[model samples]
Target: MKVSIFFKVLCVVSLIFLAGCTQGSAGTTVEDSVSLSMESETKVDETEKFNNDVDNNSEENGDNALKMLVNWKGLFYNPMVCSPYGCYEIMNRTDYTGNILYTDVVTRQRIFLSPDLSADHNNSSDPSWIDNTLGGCFLFTMDDTLFMSRYNYEDTPGELYCMDLDGRNRQSLVTFTDYNAPEGGIASDGQNLYMVLYKQDKQWLVRVHIDSGKIEPLKEMGGDAAFLTSAYGDTLVLKEIRAENTDSEDQMESYLSQIHTVYHYNITDGIETEILSWQQDKLLEEYSGEYLYLLDVDKESLKEVSLSTGEERMVIDALSAESINAEEIRSLYPIYDNHLIFDMGNDEGELKKMSVNLDNGRIFSIDPYTESLDAYGSQYLGIVGEFGDEFLVTSGTLEVPMDGIDPDGNPMVVDMVMSKLSVIKKEDFWNNRFDAMEPVEDVFLESMD
Candidate 1:
């Protein structure tokens, strides 16, 4: 059960802080401000009062209602996709075209949802034209708008679209062979929308109402394969996966053993329940809000379960907190409201970040005082912002190391990981407030030849 191993430990700490940059760009983009304008734009009114004071999102007014959630660092994954009405990047023009570069977390404006959106456009048959989203696309957000599909997973009919978190009303929203042809991708609990279709080869579970878009189906599974993952209220969570074939002769073993299970279907009455089945060496690691955390790498403990009373507790045990010892957990950041950010390895191994307090196991050490952080801070946060609920807009990556010599002269160095998109606060992180962080330095004069 290593699925999403915390997004593979935040993608191996963003590939050791971008040391392989576009080997899948792990966050960083800024400066597309494009001469800001849209009426006296003092940088979108300094991020428009963090989206116009929704009572500072309350965690006792310290921040909570998810201040327009970019939480889990604006998830969508890969090449970027943050929202509260800004931050959508994915660029590369040659090596098989691609483009979609927006950015406006409050008027630091920059556009490219097409050869011109908010600007040029003679409609090259617009479906958000840029040669029709240049072959690959997937940016999402369900009921609150902003979508761009066409990153299809085969079986044809695929296509869905939406917009208006400032990117205007670009339409087109139906066609997965007109509903119930899904292939595991999409889930929502904000009034319905959950999928996993297949039909003749069996596998349904549809549901799509959000104001009557109607699309039904409801339940059938039994052949396994599921996988969608999150959706609360009246239930939806999934994951089936099975695999076999292992006569291991140990070379670090693993010729195949998977298993996995985790259930929860019930969109009103399809009942499916189950909550957690595994394969051992535990790791599961996700599905926040109603809990399901897990992690037990050789017993350095940390768990949660209870996706609805499968019970199970113990959060952090291998020498329990005081600045960390879940085996110096090298990285696990992102768990907003119940707090929980991670990264440890002191004792001169440097890797900082740490925050914990998952309902009061208290433990802090985010040392904020950024002059663009790096007196050995290594970076890996995420939220990237303009009043991100009021401060803590993250995205990070920085690992510089350069020394060289060849041809008979010896000495080498090369670690260089640069890509950041910062914005942290709360006294710039509990009172260390120098510049209070804002690492947006921009780069991508386009590459991938």
Candidate 2:
């Protein structure tokens, strides 16, 4: 059986997502707020239930406004998104059960965005993962509206939603009962939302009209595992992972050399323009600009390519002090706050994160475990979202040797579990301010054990 741990499996490049026509109105009554405040000093047993207070209404803009909708949120670990006011996260959800919380960054005041959505959680066979045959922030936003398609990986249906930033004027857009979308299969243009969805056997690029709430299928994705990365201007970047023959006797070695292709797919017409193609051995990252970044493990160089002009600039190489042992690099992510992040594996194949500063072309290591120990007494899993120069991340409470053991014996773990969602400023993190991270006290959806 293949198990996908929420943290290490999710990979993405950085984004400038919010791209949509400013249209749409918020409706519906302002729902009541149900607050479930946890005792920050108390420790709950693993079996103790955490309550969700989803008593109101709210929404997202269009889908494209998100830098990493499905990618940013660790949909399975700690689903979160940030707005100018603060950040909204699917909190207190464990085992696919939770509610949304809006926490003000400046005031730390909290509110609810949805009612207990535990019943709505898609508990598929693979309960904790998205069906990204390929995968972020799981929801996207337009000006003040939110759009989300809820689905898990198996043969489940997906329900689309549109809402306001405050959880008011929410709309149940549509439901893909016949198809479920991989989280990365979502994007937006002007006023429409685009998605990649598949049923039992095949995949296709689909579109959703914001005003009419219409579902439109535009193109077919071949049988290979495919998904979208982000959208820019009138085009969405599409990527596909194809199997390549490496002329090696070992099948596993061939699988390691996966082929990847990225294209600028125009939303106006069904046109696809090739941008770059490389093997899985390379890493790709580009932030808000018209440039695409790559960590060429094979060439032992870091390259910056202009999307419009196809100009490639060498940023790092074997001779540079930032030189990396290409074979040991596992994965790379999009630039966030001008820092290019990548994962490098140790001799035992354990992955650790490293950061590259584009301005200075200097390298720094991001030790999530040590960082977590300083803040949550847990292990940092992945990033949740970026809000006001700060980032909210998910960190797992250290697991007991035997999960079925009594959970009450560990108060420190319990406190960390309650506040598993931690927030740290991008500047603080870059400066290695691990102690500066503060935990958000959203309860778990289920037992951590």
Candidate 3:
């Protein structure tokens, strides 16, 4: 008998509890009379109110009360496609009038505003008029300011422009004479900006002072490579792939084409270390603490490695090896504190979550989303925002053309759909477990038969 795929019933249950606790207030305009000091006060007051509601509702609903903070209405993008700064939500893709937006994973509010290209450039012409594009990746935000890299194709010498998040202050930071910006370069620590440049089979890490637009080379990892993934905290974890090996390039038909590795680079010491390597596709995810979770191509197992010590532990292993294939590893997210949420596909291509135990090698089915797989497989999942007892879930799907127009002559019905933000309560998540199943003891155990 085919097993019934479990839906994230906890997410739905949490949503029910959150709906009761949240109290909506009137929207405040950006030009409100509140001073900067008063603005801080207002934010605190709003946060308190949100927290109070969550606390009260969670208490009433018992353990099932996970709070849903904000049900923000805006466009969403795949986090995987995002730059190190974060993902950008296309406000208007057809006419290309979108903004680079980020959601507070906890509060679910569209917190940071990206610089508006059309408004900043003052070019009412369609976005197609521009040769090189901007504003489709994560952004770095500090205080009232945000920064992102823009590609200026029309300029005599194509350059990467660093502009304010609001599209006000624009300046050229780096000039690329014979190259273009690679995806996943820009990262920020609220004070400094780090960017990566690829040229002539070499990768250079560039550091730019956000205040002065000053550029400096930090280090170079040898390869015609693109930044794969990054995590920020006390130390920075970056993953890059060596794209050009003559022999490997020739054998492109094989699944393992390049050397994929993760580099643990220290921000204070400017030292770098190669932490891990694999022959096939691998993924690295950093959690709240110093733990880094590595998931390989086959969904058969997962390894949790500590950054402090090079020690590694196998936290999960394949339950049904035949049922779990290499292509089924869809998406991964750090859930709560210790648990990890991952999605995998069955033979039918349906997605299912397998909650793996961090302390032990235990796995159980959790939930499923109805959306079909995109070219890259499962949709990117992220925490929108969290208040007290509530959290929000935001998801974006592929665009579909619409038939309508606004009062302005600009086409109103661009295909970009605002993310579907669902409110979830903390109480709904059940901290339970599946019946304990022994892992494959040893290869020789079954051979004894």
Task: Report each candidate's C-alpha RMSD, comma-separated, in the order given.
Answer: 22.3, 11.1, 14.5
lDDT of 3: 0.41
lDDT scores of the candidates, listed in order: 0.46, 0.50, 0.41
Among these predictions, the greatest lDDT belongs to: 2
Q: Tens digits of per-residue lDDT for model 3 on 1-449?
A: 11111111111212101111222222211122112213343233443322211112112223322221111100121221111112223233333333343322222233223222113321433221222344332233333443343433444443555543334455555565544453443445556656565655677776657566566667776644545244345355566666445554457634355666777777678888888766545553533234567765555567877765778887756635535454667656533424566667767877676666576756655553234324445443344334344344443332334334555655454343334444445334323211211111111112112
**Candidates 1 and 3, the one with greater lDDT:** 1
TM-scores of all predicted structures: 0.31, 0.67, 0.59
lDDT of 1 at 206: 73
lDDT of 1 by residue, 235-294 (tens): 656777654435566533452365677787766677887876776334535555356666
**N/CA/C clash count, model 2:** 37
Clashing pairs in model 1, backbone N/Cα/C closer than 3 A: 57-64, 382-394, 382-395, 383-393, 383-394, 384-393, 384-394
